[model samples]
Target chain A: MTTTAINTKQFMTSEQLLEHWQGHRNLTRRVIEAFPEKELFEFSVGGMRPFAKLAVELISIGGPALKGIVEKKMDAHDEESFNPKTKAELLNKWDEETEVINRYFGQISEERFQETFNLFGQYEFPVYQNILYFVDNEIHHRGQGYVYLRALGMEPPFFWERF
Target chain B: MTTTAINTKQFMTSEQLLEHWQGHRNLTRRVIEAFPEKELFEFSVGGMRPFAKLAVELISIGGPALKGIVEKKMDAHDEESFNPKTKAELLNKWDEETEVINRYFGQISEERFQETFNLFGQYEFPVYQNILYFVDNEIHHRGQGYVYLRALGMEPPFFWERF
Candidate 1:
């Protein structure tokens, strides 16, 4: 009898995925810190929103979305709810949200990751995909931040140096 | 005897991952198409590199990196080689690279993906993480493209509409 090797290997555990995501988060937080206080709030490229606004959008989504996912609450997307006027204020919120994400993300079981959930009452996708969306969206914004930093004649964190 | 369900289910197949990456690529291609020829090459916010240059970086990496992975070639990264002068020329190269990615990506066996690869003679990582890096990097640059498009008063393709 001839048989093929059915690949049963796990690609990544949930914990590994979390670590990978948090690595990106750490990089993004650095990006946020890299910006000049005034520029973070006031810089723009080709009429794009400043990095501060972009960072706020991320802050609004990640921890809240994970909390929503864990709690099974499909609250409407809220970009305007949290507004920080200063860099320190924003970073404080960011740290708080990081803790929130860690708490909620750990609560998701492997099976639940396969279940479909409507994120923020829109963007219906599997729980894992939703998490991926959060990560992907963050990376995209961080790329813009890199550009913004370069325009400001400052160096942003290296993309591959995520630990 | 009591036993717990050992979560052996797969999160995504290699095929599914390919499709996911391609979806982002399709969205990015649309962004490239949306840019005015001059603006694509010349536009900047805060002195960041132009979208054209960023697009070239993607082109330089994706297909070649995949080929390198499949062939086990540790060739150095090359971003300065292909110089497309027009939008049409760049798009053609993009299309060609897409095919190249498909071809090389398929050649990697399931076991091989778990192997470590020194991508571009730098950035040593497991093959799967290397692939993830490519996707993440693309999303990041495309994010910059979104800002550029908006600054020009043109609507970008929705980030979620990747198909």
Candidate 2:
């Protein structure tokens, strides 16, 4: 850690990262909800990944990574992440994972934000960037979700209204 | 400038933010380029904003917001943002604003990251948060772009490949 004269209190508050991340999570949950059952799992444009598969990827990352962060575990993340059978099961897992995120977010100390923890023992960045990857990956997949929804002749939830 | 013991030097670097943001911009620009010329401005789902309007809104936010951040000149942002009658015109405008973003991002300093600045003479926050709003808004709009692209039977660029 470079101890420069400048302080790092506001580089990113835990609250800010949490809220920013949760906001994306909330929007993604809505995106999942908007899809028809069959289309949610099957719809794709030009042979791209389906929304169900993408949502499963997000489910795999969020809750498990939070546990690893708090418990100092570097468990391998290459398992077949999530394979929920139905849309209802997917939503349940997403909710369960959201709770996991909230709980683990509470366990993080301000000092932990600065510590170097090897994420899954592969990506070696600070905790902040790791958390951001969660959001960035979600946004990328959710963009695919939007594509799927529009292809199915359905309107997605407004992008600006995330609570 | 809260100077504390644990240093937060690597929470985010200027280069990281630029690379991350520029990657998103490249993907969004490609999304714009993928649209059929007639549909780029006209298509919509259930009366929500069109992709073209959303693209206009992004154009308004990105370059103008960067100018505000680096130059400390908070220009009003409520006029007609971009009115390209042709897809070629819109692409030209996107390239122009991207250049503006590159020029302005160079002007920001590490110290400027810590300062609290009101974005567009409203939405006051730290400069980093403001910069993030630009990226967040773009992602949100670009999701719409993806939807539009799929509706047109076109494929958007892979989200993670740009870097």
Candidate 3:
């Protein structure tokens, strides 16, 4: 599949995208920090899944995808691989994955950003587009985290402070 | 304000970014289509702003930014400029801006992506980062739209269909 618009003109580098992704990740970590323990696991709006479940979905995707990309291994998403029983465990898992990403993202060389890789054996695209996907997806989910925090009467980390 | 991790390694082109952004915009428009009339404007979880408010903020930002980039003009964000009373009005406004973006995005030269501009007279960054910010912000809000739809017992359009 043609996964991106294919404008490989190079506006940003691998390291830059990595930092961009991590900055958003840092802000998201703050969002996780602000969540009330019970609300993180139990709060629901109009029957939507709790923020914890959604957070786990994000936590499950990133590190695994980056590992797959770096290792050239493919694994379809498996929810059973992680079943965090509490907010603390979930947060710990998220931080562990963040560490994994920081390590693995750097392993992919600059040229790799231009090569096409089948992401999770599903998306076949350049490494740059795949990296953009990771950043875009996190920002998207973080949007929800913002709402969940607001609903709980808490202020989320400032959106601009993604560092 | 250095707003991005600017390595200036150059990986994507202006046209490619525009296409990528349009793809995301297409999905978001479909998301807007999925909203129920009343819930689009009235629904809120906790004390979060309604999805309609979020949508307008997006609609307001993009077209003007593109116009600014294309014409070398700058306008600070003024929230009072829009206060849509209904979903139809909001959707119409969104379409108008999309058309504006479509027209102006093409006017940007390839080299323009490397030049720094103050997005909304606030963020001083390269044209590429500013464009990325537009896409990033939209995906973030679309995340909220997803939650609102799911909470209303509605399934959103699949997120990957950016065409």
Candidate 4:
């Protein structure tokens, strides 16, 4: 059988993928909430960027990438644009972006997932792969936040409890 | 349209999923290789488990879970079964398990991805979700390893360079 024939069966619906991504996002938001303001901004092990900075990087990517995908715009990637001076401000932007994600994500039809889209004018891949990268990148960074929390003698939300 | 109808288009092929997962495994192996022998087992921040122990947890999960799925076995989850004293020994077992993953992963029919499998007599999820958990869990721990390496003044493999 041809590759296309064998792959005709769905691995997941667009809605299921959105739910999965949002679940991870919810868990990440909790990780951000677990930190004290000082540690979120200043704590680091071995000079790695602080958890707050990591959160900023994620915030920069998700909504912007989805907007780019839907709009077919390859704007240059910008990680420095959104600077949250406090945890509360950061959380507000995060909550707002979640809505941005929901809106742009809904605009992607099933057929669009298989089409290649150059993400942020770089890293060209199928739309689904780009979306997977967003989720994967979040998990990787949240993993770092988990370590930071542990090192601070604080408990992070369970990794599996992505609601 | 019914959810099933909307989902008829493929999100990814089984082989593509395997490739994506193995890319992660390859990067994780690099993380293991970066650690000093003593630190791999004994290093910690805030009493978190060392990278070696985290690696052991992953080693215990992936191949065994696939075996359980292919053979219809639900053996109790065991993280303490394989203890590696040295980095060499750990990498050896990692290589063996990679082959084991390749072998057993091949036996799972595409249709089986949707079937519910109670993994390790613990988490009951669709086989694909269980597999994803394995990958997600690996990335999570590896993220910790990245932090540990940074703290130790060592550089981890780039998160994006999985291959």
Candidate 5:
């Protein structure tokens, strides 16, 4: 294998990491799917932020950050804004962004792994750190998803496997 | 606050991020706490992996990743050999890692944000991507955390807000 290909293979071979990412996204979709349209924005824990807001934040973070990576521009403020009033709308946007993530991820060159870029024009960090941040940010909010699921007494997807 | 401080406040602010991170760990801990010890290791979703294995993965990801960031070493493969035996042990380790993250984050200067680093010695992603991955990975698994919580009839943390 070429050196770049070999390196990619070694990193991409992390089944757990891949599974973890896909699984979490799948689960987040499920949680959104499970919520009643009204509850999406109203649900909270102790006057905390609403799941809807958090979802928007997640969507906002991914595409814009990727854009920042691609364009090598730092967003000084909230980069992308999508306000979906209904569950269907949010899901559609979610799916669209998911595709964006996959497409962007596919475009990542091994040579650019160490490249530094600014996200939101505020923090100048490396490309890898931002990517991990995207995944980590998603998982963090998805934890909230679990709470919402439990509150609704709805059975969420099985946690053991990501399919 | 000065303009620069104001401009960079969001990126420099680790409080919300840390809250999200800690909140996730706490929720995941709850998932494990709710499960019967025997089932912790045996429970599977759709013939997939068990929650216990997933937890181990979470613990393994955090410490070494943070260490990598602090030390500015990208090719750290120390995560491969980490395996914690008990829930308490993992929790203790997690607590320590949380502190580590806080300390490391505090020490990072705004000027140094763009430094590049490798993750797992494979991806040539930047330092930003690495940090993002650290948090994103946690969120992914934490989604499973919701599943586990639901299965156990326990309420996970609220999805919308960090407390």
Candidate 6:
């Protein structure tokens, strides 16, 4: 009898993907909560960017890019149209997008992960590359949040042990 | 009539700092919400480290370092206990630390931000440098989140336009 090779091409099960995504999001959320409202916007280190701008960037990118992935469409331009005047408003938007992401994730099929797509009309990469990009981006920004937290003399959330 | 010069240092009041911090936190929470739970602990990009490990490092450095800044005390061996088990538990701890940060920020005087402090018994940096680290670290992680979000076919939050 011949043994069949295991199919490594199978994408992550929806359950697995969702779990990892949520875990990362939760960690990022903790970092945000650790900050005081004042430092979130005006605080800076060594002429670097402020925490608020960085947060805006995260919002602008995460929502639309994910939407594009689900729809199988590539955005020709970067994200625009971010307008939150207060911390409350930002939180409200954050809550709204959380639901949006879940809905989008629900629609993904395993076969879709194997399909290749164009990101920002720049690179022709596999779906896996795009997925990796999502995780990488979040980690990058979270690192910035760590810096801000330290500057303010406040503890941030732990990085390891997210299940 | 002589015009009085406004102190640039005084402009960044504690209230403003708090708002900024809160806004940053809210945005980060959205990033966490972008992903599923399991990936939070297991996902990795290239040969790079997992986001979970990074979160642990953040937690370890963030709290004690902040305390050191506020108390004007520094210890070299503070980066040892940066481990956790589950994503939910990590998030819970993140929430707790947020409260501590708020309390610490509330006590900050404008004079204190300019005061210098030592970090990890190795680097002698100003309070501002330490504060900036928190925000910077967040950005770094969030960048990774962005990559993950892209891969997951979900959009990340905007980098700018945080209120």
Interface Cα root-mean-square deviation for all models = 3.6, 5.6, 3.2, 2.2, 13.9, 23.9
Estimate, for each residue in B30-77, the C-alpha lDDT of model 5 and write its tens digit: 666666666676764334456777777777666666666677676645
Task: List all candidate RMSDs to the true structure.
Answer: 3.4, 5.1, 4.5, 1.9, 12.6, 21.6
For each candidate, the alpha-carbon lDDT, in order, equals: 0.85, 0.76, 0.78, 0.88, 0.61, 0.59
Point to the candidate with the largest lDDT: 4
Q: Between candidates 1 and 4, name the one with more favorable lDDT.
A: 4
lDDT string, candidate 6, A1-163, tens digits: 1112112211223444455566677776666667777777777554455666666776666666668778877777454577656666666776677777777755555556556778656546555446545654666767656656765667667774343
The prediction achieving the highest DockQ against the true structure is 4
lDDT (10s digit) by residue, model 1, range B29-124: 999999999999999676677899999999999999999998889999999999989999999999998899988877777778778999999979
Cα lDDT of model 3 by residue, B1-163, tens digit: 2224334445555555677788888888788778887888888676676788888888888888889888887788765789888778887888788789989887776567768998778889888778877888899889888888877788888877788
TM-score of chain A of each: 0.93, 0.90, 0.87, 0.95, 0.81, 0.83
Candidate 4, residue A117: Cα displacement in angstroms equals: 2.1
Where does candidate 4 clash, by residue pair? A46-B151
Say which docking band candidate 1 falls in: acceptable
**Model 6, span B83-154: residue lDDT tens:** 656777767766677777776665555556566667777656556546645654665666655555554566
When candidate 3 is compared with the true two-chain complex, its DockQ is: 0.50
Expressed as tens digits, the lDDT of each residue in A1-163 for candidate 3 is: 2224334445555555677778888888888778888888888666777777877878877888888889999778665678777778988988898899988876776667678999888899987778777778778777887777777778788887877
For DockQ, candidate 4 versus 5, the one ahead is 4
lDDT of 2 by residue, A1-163 (tens): 4424233323444665677788888899999888889888887865667888888888888888878989999997753846887999999989988889988876777667567789887867678668877888788678667766766778778765568
lDDT of 5 by residue, A1-163 (tens): 5434322222221222333466667777877887878888787654445677878888888766776677777756572557778889888988898777755654445445456777787757566556656766676677666566566666656543345
Q: Considering summed lDDT, which 10 consecutive residues are worst modelled in model 2 chain B?
A: B1-10
What order do candidates take by DockQ, descending?
Answer: 4, 3, 1, 2, 5, 6
Off by over 4 Å in 4: A2-10, B2-9
- For each candidate, what's the DockQ? 0.39, 0.23, 0.50, 0.57, 0.10, 0.07
Query: What fraction of native interface contacts does model 3 preserve?
Result: 0.59
The number of clashing residue pairs in each candidate reads 2, 0, 6, 1, 35, 149
**How far in Å is the alpha carbon of A90 misplaced in model 4?**
1.2
DockQ value of candidate 4: 0.57
